[model samples]
Target: MPSYLSPGVYPRETDFSFYVKQISTSSAAMVGVAEKGPINKPTLVTSWEQFLKTFGGYINEGYLAYAARAFFDNGGSVLYVCRVAHYADPTDRNTLSGQKAAAKLVSQMDMYLLNGDPDPLPPQEVYDVFAINEGIWANRLEVQIENVGLSGGTFLLSVIYKGETVERFTDVSSDENATDFVELRVNGVSDYITIHDIWEPVGDTGMGTPRGGTYALSGGENGVVDMADSDYIGDPSQHTGLFAFDEVDALNLLMVPGVTTVPVINAGIGYAESRKDLLFIADAPPMLEPLDVVNFRKGQGTYTHAAFNSSYAALYYPWLEISDPVTAQKKNIPPSGAVAGCCARSDQKTHVWWAPAGIDRGRIFNALTVAYKTSRGERDVLYPEGINTIAVFPDTGINIWGQKTLQSQPSAVDRVNVRRLMMYIEEAISESSRFVVFEPNNPQTWRALGRLINPFLQDIKEKGGLYDYAFQCDEETNTPVVIDRNEMMARVFVKPTKTAEFIELNFILSGTGAVFSELIP
Candidate 1:
């Protein structure tokens, strides 16, 4: 409010327009073991090549690299990769024994007492060199040092991996305060190794520099041995494993690729449901018969009392077969990665309300075949149990054939499209409505909220995401008691657009004299 004294006319500017910012619903996140990278960190990589450069190439121990490659090949454009590894003790990083290989570079200097007697101290360590990440790949790296400059006070450092020079730093000094100190030159910038200067000047002794020699890093380990379910469902407080995704702001889908253990799947479901925004793409074990898959879904047979039922999760069965880039042999891996990519493609090509299954949008790339080619009868058994099938057809190659969520109770949300559509709308609106938090809870504010939200829902309605929607933010919903409680309430009612999973056609043959209009009626 503004006050004016003795003013004939007053001018004021007002803003009457409000809008909801559109949110992206295509980004996805995955958790798995990698060959080498920052462990338990949610690193975003937009392309397969970037993932490889950051996380290293495929390893024989884990299916992470394979799934990541399949994701990008299948049409996923943005992915957040969280690399998990086993540790003997989760609280102490030092217990990550043998994870990081290291070597100590020493400076040999002849020292004597003032009375011309030899000093008893041995050579002093000048620098400690460590691999950039924890993995066996760093064991092959060798560091080379050479004395340089007129005074020979600085050294040239070269890092070689498998006899190929990967990094070189010249005129690097051991002095901690020097502009070209070894730590400053190589710690963050070098891709292969990091250097720590430990050299300290001894009183009246000759200044020491790193001895010129080639030293190979040792004691490196992959740290994936004896991995347990707890490793994948890491401590949420520490933000490791599935919880590492907490660092990501917006994720539409989640996966722990190739890990289909009952405990892990259950953990992932609970986590996704708690987030209320993303869908967890779960995997059935590879090479399971149709009956076995059904039994698994029903908490019977091999699974023996484990079941999954959630609108925030979808399970896909029968692994996909792709030629391994590292082994050059056909391998069967989980389908969640490829399915996530299909969901992303569907969101991009159409609306989130559209089913991601069927031939047009569910075709998987980089996969040669399915582990099990299910028959129509088998699909009938699988689909009803909420296990999505990756069917391989002679004419259509490999495509996702179902879109049911793990939800056992049949309803509109039992389908993946409807569940995801609700997630998208709810997340987008709730996120964009933060501005109305401290505004006055009056008719003007209520109308402002309506003006902000109605068009957004209308846009979704017009785009086929919703059949219809209604929004109310007034005394009926936010009465005096609610306003007095310092709360503003808005009611959003939506009829989500449903997918046509089954289409029926009726044909009639009429006599030549029969009228077409009478037959139609």
Candidate 2:
């Protein structure tokens, strides 16, 4: 029955009980929060048994290993494990869970790419993976997937630091320009990753680079490289070291849209970090020679196989920006027994990437960051902290993709790279391309350094002055010669070894420069 109310308000039936059991029941049962001090972060997986149950279906012999991996990927600081007992029963799921539960989380975690267990006297484990862009190893992320428990294949792992937050760049979805849901992505998250949708994703639309021009690089304000060398090396004259162009840099060309042919996926995953700037990546371009490479931002710098063959030789995109994985299951295990030796995709070099945006920020890279003496003789981290991102290109096969088996290196890097570079020198000489072995073979060097002969390269004295060089691509003779005139910005390199007498290297020397996504790309 409704209450008969006059001008005054009537009593509502919502009276709650607070003191009903005050004496009998204490205050701890109501709110489980601690009184204060250092608080523990809430964990998604509460119990070891529950975690094992949930992941066993998607797991193998590894339960705790995979969970630790996800936690590290999302920037977990302290891990309080409850290791119950010791058990080597790989297939026993219950045994594994009980053992893991007994372990407590490590309160202070230092995140690094290649971190081996701190067992007695283990030399720093090397876990570095690399990316193959254009059949060449370019982006190198030095990291190791420590715990062995995750699916393998081509994957990009991202991480979002717990103490850090960044806005994602995206379009406003509302009809009226409302600033509610911004488009963005970070390093660490629950599981699924989100990417923003953009119109005309690649510059192949009306916004691509123009022909006959070059990619423009934006340098940080107040820096300079020589002018003659600048035009020759595909480098730019900008303050921020970013390449700018009226069109796409030929290196970043995507599939020509509207051609009905499948659009090649360039820039697979783009991440915009807050402590840093935007990070972007393009999938390896196709194997077609005379391939049109497009640079996204500058909308400039168009070239073909001829450019890579002669003029521009030392460029290969290798690393990728991805979330870090805690589990090392089914990942690429280098012959060296190192977890983070190479990328999970092709097994070259694996690393976490950050977009070092401002003066206050920097990025991470592969390789144990030891305090190394720089050329200036000052000690510094091999890679700096606060670094958000970095870009590295390897010189390898530019025609194909895939990992190097026990038999051979990635053909795109080995075969195509060999022939391409040799073709130039072959044209300059009268002989056909042939790898000549003149010296007695030494097994120690090969055993020590493998096929990497660059370390034995003799030093060439630098004569600094304005020099000239040209890429004489004889479409007729099927050869190209990069003529180093008096030797300007680039130099002729030959690495002599016991097995392979002379290996080739053409170093395109340039001042400090950086690679960034073009605002226009």
Candidate 3:
């Protein structure tokens, strides 16, 4: 056949139709084959122990393998795996399910809280006023209308309903500022009461605005923020701060990535035999250090667990798992829980937080308040609106804010010494609204201010950089910001620069001095 292929057009060769018969069909083609494991097992079984877990949790159910195989057999072309955690705890439910069991227990708890009514505990019936009356389709947000006060005189209102300052107004009707007054805004946000309910002066016994033992804190201006790094009271910083150390021991409980150390604060009151945490908890323990044993006692079943989120105030506001100003500022007693124990106050800026002034001076709030300066004259006001927030300068020399008792009057009155210190901040080169920052060429001062502002303004503002940082800018610069001791003095002497009320803007350029906030580890 090879020689016959030369004559296809004119000369005839062997017929092509006979060629298929000569060549075997089976031997005609060659194909590559993929290898597989020795043959027959169908389903892959996985042991419970084979499941992956992390951080006291299970991640893989192993059903993924079967799904993957099925998908491979079907039309699923390709897929990728996403790591995850099993949110549902599959402990034990037996014939039922673990989730069902947990759900049953939780439902029973809800039922118990429901007391007898369809609503959960019938809102506890503690003189409820106004909350969204939502957050609960079938439950209610128990509210208390307390600390209503007069501003100028007619009938201003201090409307506190369900953990919020709904509104505040200046009652210019009467010349005197009434201590207790509540004006209900009929149509606004917390429209709990009416104009008629605004000024109902019941009596002193019934109307005396609750004060934390009438102890208003005040402190002279110190140009530095307050900082507290208390680990174990018997540890190091407590000795430097001259705070009392007894009762609760220090702990390494609180920890962050780079920061490791926490103050173990003891709540004074506890059950006769039982309590939470290794250290005992109580409303107030005797011979306490940082603050007076005064507590705005709380009653049973009153406060929610959302208030304890703040590490500093967790001991006093044990019921709060949330760090809201409204809940943190409230006064407390025995079961009614309030951390009236400690504070950081300057004549200008006073911050009230929860760490009680107990024997464990190593406590965060305790360390902060003790080192904080107390005013000889008036308080230093930082922001125009009442300050409901607090921050510590990590490795900074000072701690700010403390056991502050707010007045029923809109303008907070310090029952204890309170001040906010700002330090070694770069001074204003000129008198304009803005200025350049001094380079931290001096390593000592660099570390001083550098340590002072961290964990707070780390990403936002570097230690020594361009002073012109817009609130939301992401650029880094090398401008200097000087500590205007004069500005601090001005805050003490002149009225707050910005406010809805009157305007009083004066400058104290001379005689202003710089202060340092020291935090000894």
Model 2: ten consecutive residues of lowest lDDT: 22-31
Candidate 1: where are CA atoms >4 Å away? 90-94, 108-122, 150-152, 203-206
Q: Could you say which candidate leads in TM-score?
A: 1
Selected candidate, larger lDDT, 2 vs 3: 3
- Sorted on TM-score, best first, the list reads 1, 2, 3
lDDT of 3: 0.21
Best by lDDT: 1
TM-score, candidate 3, is 0.15
Global Cα RMSD, each model: 2.1, 34.8, 34.5
lDDT of 2 by residue, 27-92 (tens): 000000111111111123333344332222222222233333322222222222211111123223
TM-score of each: 0.95, 0.15, 0.15
The Cα RMSD of model 1 versus the native structure comes to 2.1
Candidate 3 structure quality by residue, lDDT tens digits, 27-126: 0000000011101111121221121110011112212222222222222222221111111121211211101000000000122333565555321111
